[model samples]
Target: MKKLVNCFIGLTIGLFSWTGALSQISIEEFAINFSQPVDIANAGDGSNRLFIVEKVGRIQVLDEDGQKGEQPFLDISSKVDSDASEEGLLGLVFHPEYQQNGYFFVYYTATVNSIRDAVIERYSVSADSSLAEHSSGVEVMRINQPQSNHNGGDMAFGPEGNLYIGVGDGGSGNDPGERSQNLTLPLGKMLRINVDNLPYSIPANNPYAQMGGDTVREIWAVGLRNPWRFSFDDNYDLWIGDVGQSAREEINFISASENVGGLNYGWDCREGDIACPGCGNNQCDEQTFTDPVHWYGPGPGLSVTGGYVMRGEFYNVFEGHYIFAEFARDQIRTLQLSPGRSVAITATIPANNISSFGEDEKGRVYAANLSGIIYRVVEAGILPVELIAVHIKKENKKVFLDWETGFEFNASHFEVERSLGQESFKQVGIVPSKGDAGEITNYQFIDQVYRPGDYSYRLKSMDLDGSYTYSMNLTIKIENNEDMLVLPNPALDKIRVGLPVMQEAGHLQIVGLDGAILHRIAVSPGDEDAIEIDVKEFRRGLVLVQFIGEGNISFTKKLMLY
Candidate 1:
């Protein structure tokens, strides 16, 4: 039901206007109608379709032209535990022989006997070719999670056809247990195992393979603090975006040409080339650990979302550019590592939570916003704000309109347009934008109805350059008097309900989804303009605001509180 309305707003907004060597990078919505997408991958079965993994335990299929299928390819929402935003159906990968074996794998967090476990499981596709056989799931690995915050939930098959899993240091501030450097557990390491065997097998070349001291044989590389996302280039070179604790964000790169195992990436003691403080006083020598190839601190981002190296149709100058994003600041960057780590900041994409970045079969990169929109990363462009949602509601002789934004670039203002029935739309109100990049902004407008007819409304998001895009139309029919207007919906703390001009008294009841009343207030409407309902104590999510008036209850409307 949260599917976005703007699909064709910026179909060609500077997506192909720049081809310079150092062109700025931007993004456009590639697919819509996803619910909290955290990761995306392509099944290499020659279909070229992208499979998006949602935090609610569903994997959906989207075709090349941004078209998505109505049905999900896989659904295991019942098996996954996503109570914690950090945990969910996080990663997906197809078997090298997916065309024949119909096999694929997923990584998620689930509760077993009251303990959360990071689980890796495999499944085969159903006969329908688009759905997975529910009964064909097989558990490959399950590691007990120490906390919910830092489950490094991403996976990929190395160039050697083995599964490589990224895990976090047993989650707490500063790795209290010092698990990343511990070899006895898999908590904070890059684990490589052979999935061809049931329940998985340890690769012989792993660091601990020859050791007999109870060291984990699944450990390939050690000392990583939440390797949230990582990928490999054609040469099997690894690029890691390690999320920092408090100081800085760092990227770990391991060239396959090095041909070595048991590489240690410093954590707990070091963060982003600087000695970490408040880390339980742990110390390390400069020779004991490898530092990041590139690092940056706060304003840009501390929650780094790793990305891929472009290998297919890309900007003319970025043949080997490694593109990544900062989840904290909603910014993307391109890096060159030939001579040394050289980084360039890309444009800031909105809906700030950039959970993950993925590449399609053609090597076109895309970014996934946890707020439910996937965007295609392209060369320099003006990324405009898409009116993702527009809600229209009526209360006594008046219609209220409100909507939310996802991306904004050089945004000027918004013009609210209204139409009567099939008539042409005319501008009714102009709302100035907050103009803050990387922030979620909301706008509202109201139109009065004198006669009974259907009314439609849309928004014209105007850019600084004078280019404008129209959002999908929202229509509502008027049968009676429609006046209690609610402003700042999807609100945070409070909302003002515009009461009827003549009405003086009523009872306001806040109802939850379970049909239970959460708050009750008596309104003494008089000289006041509107009734201010304090919803700061109510839980975040959907709630019904009902007005109990003279003879019958005036209106029951749904208000979203985030």
Candidate 2:
């Protein structure tokens, strides 16, 4: 949800210092079935699991290795107030040394003494590391909010080992109280606190730490309408995507050297390099304000959702690029930061409704949308090959499978896997890929069965780099008694043939290709449904099995004796 929808200008919105064309990227679906998932994060612990924050006050655990737990890692819905569209459990971050301390924190809205407030509480992990011990919650900090729209609920542990919280200006049309520029209040400001000190303590270097009376000691930086999302890169540079009010949306850059606290981001006073449309007098406007590294008018987008630098090792193509998205525009793009703090829109990605972006322990990137789906960003032309058409045919105790791929790229091969009953899937066969080409490729695999049972089969599409994805399951059932079908088609000594349920007796004969009878038997409707034949005395060759019943009714099938 956007804080402000005031698109007053036709916006010749300048995307300050940007290159026109950039490399193209795309997304592959990674996970699904979440409700209004608003944030993503990972525990610094070596577990490699990614935590998904749902807006309704629950955090889910998703493991990339196919071991997702059915229950949420943390569920605080009972204590969270999500009555307003903007109010809810919004943010989560694990302590840097979570493995040792088992500490984590949350930012959410809850009613305390009949007043709504933004609550920051600490919790610990349970013995089962994937879940949290619900009763361990300890209140860290709480601040009353005048409105729900601009809670600015985003949190991260800074390189200095302190917790920084982004608080939006007490929400209303155009900062009625001018809270953003006021350094005396915690609202409309970025606050830094030391959570290591239990209920939390003020950092000695916080801008207003020594200020007395009405001054807020937790205030580190002021003048932000709503810093909805922000991040600190490996370089310790703080990047913020502050939602706009009337005319422009912007991205602010705080380089490591300029991050020594007490910096103002022009919000209510000036929106994106321009003077606040209606304002106060004289040199009060001359107060030094840090300009956005990039800004754009409402013509392009209304709200900006901040992103992280792609520093993951697996996907190195976007090595140093900065990625961000527009909540109202439903688009994701990347910016490459050149020297002098100037950045350009260098790439566009194919994803939609992206409410937030997240990174895993391996630095791999992921994104989640309001529509309950999670996507993984991938290079444009290298998606894993998928089977577009698949078919199965059962004949004489043999299952024949065929499938086709619409396109292939860096494909290694396909593995045919099968599951019997509820057993785990096991590889049955492998078919080498047709190499990297845009043309459709057809492949086939045959699964032999000697016993009749239910079978489920699927393809495992492989990439040259060893990554793989599975196709939907195709199920085929092989029954022992069907017409005059034969089990153990290529028999060394014996075979079973279906017996016809007849009104009278019938003779079952195995006739060789040369018209000689190899075996014979009498089957009646009152007897068993199958007749076993011995062929150990016969030479290894193809033969036909014939069944003659009442009214000249007969069924015949070709069989192989090995």
Candidate 3:
């Protein structure tokens, strides 16, 4: 009956796009008919066929283009004892080297004599691309559970060729058994193991193995309550969204290269830096267990939904952003991370009972709803904002104006305008759009040959119906001055700087490619002979060098640091 009600709700909200209030994000519902789809995975083989995991122990196929396939790829519902509610099929993973191995693994509650145990079983598809129930599964590993609730379920292959698994705090709120904090137990922790060798092999570099302690050798990072889902970015950064008890929901990020062995995420010790009554101050070590970079409490949702980092080139704002969801309230939020260990919310998408987020071969993300609908997050582009960029070059005075349809709307053309000072303006040109780009779109117009001195440009992206909106004016100045230069474009260790002679001190700032300011210093050619900027701590990316010298002169240069 509950499933029937959920199906009805999904059918009711099936026809429209879910747009949240904060940012210009649009969602399209696809693969609507399913029985409690919990997670989805792409084959990455250009087949466009997506494997959707049903929590009730089944794998359905969605066509590469996101159309619902007529049949399921695999179903082990009879083998699973889901009487315990959380016991059915929880996670599924395809071997990264699957083309050669033809291997797959599933995490589920296998029932034997009415006793349900958390098990990871490996299965291979038949030559016909179907699974058989003739007991063709090999039990890779199994952990006996006293209770059923917190079966931290989700698995993914990391860049280092390791399979990572998430385990819960062994059920019942507040971690009654304290299993998450106990390194000896696998519960309430994330485990990483190498499956290249038959069943599974423990990696030599696994933090616990080298540390020589009571920690579980397969444990990657510990102290997680119940991480429903976690995935690695293209660069292998691990983003884990762990479910909170009562007060918080968190998103944890760890750099792949930085080996933080036995990193405790303060589950019972702390939830997002707030102490729980059960965890005392004296018990909490001053070692500063890494708290979540950002977290929120249940305001609109019951549980926190984990998502993936968008590395696809199709969208700009979504790139490098971690898109997450709230299960109870159906809100999709984006966390923008900075090099300096800071994060900000760029946008939040609207959703309902969003159980999991999946990625396809093209790197676009998909959100699975318990309401029986699956939605893919595509770059609908920002609503057409009237804006222009002015570039001044010798013999080529150019003005670039960009506009597009805003969220949930369609835009058509853009009218460009030019201003001499800040007041008097004249019509420049009219750029026509390719019609309504249902999603956010980026359009540009260039105007050549303009008068000297400072110039400003504005634009209005109009709708096909004659309604329009204005854009922020862009300003540019035509000038030539080689005031500063950063040697060794791909800089390392120490970077040399050459500054033009100035009367007073100048301010120097190093901004990352993401517009994050990393280093700032005041330097004056008259005061200091030269400045050597340190590039050791910098990661591989494009950087901006800003120099503000005497006479308030500002110079910007892009530096590539490896």
Q: Higher TM-score: candidate 1 or 2? A: 1
Q: Any idea what lDDT model 1 has?
A: 0.77
| Residue ranges of candidate 3 with Cα displaced over 4 Å | 1-23, 130-135, 210-215, 278-283, 286-288, 298-301, 382-562
lDDT of 3 by residue, 337-385 (tens): 9999899887654456788889888887888887577877755433433
lDDT of 1 by residue, 1-562 (tens): 1122222212222332221222344566677668999998988888888899999999999988878887999999999999987888989988888898999999999987889899989999999888899999999999888998789978888867888999998797888888888889898898998887686888788778888776888999888899989999878989999999878788888888763678888887788788775576344665377789888874333698898887766654456778787886655667777755555443233334688889888788888987677977766434356555678999866789988875566788988888765466788789987664544567888776544568778778777877565564577887633545666688899887755544446787889999999988876645343567889999999998888876554877789999
Could you tell me every candidate's TM-score relative to the true structure? 0.69, 0.65, 0.63
Angstrom error at residue 205, model 3: 1.4
Q: Quote the positional error of residue 323 for candidate 1 in Å.
A: 2.0
Full-model lDDT, candidate 2: 0.77
What shift in Å separates residue 17 of candidate 1 from its native position after superposition?
16
User: What's the lDDT for all of these models?
Assistant: 0.77, 0.77, 0.71
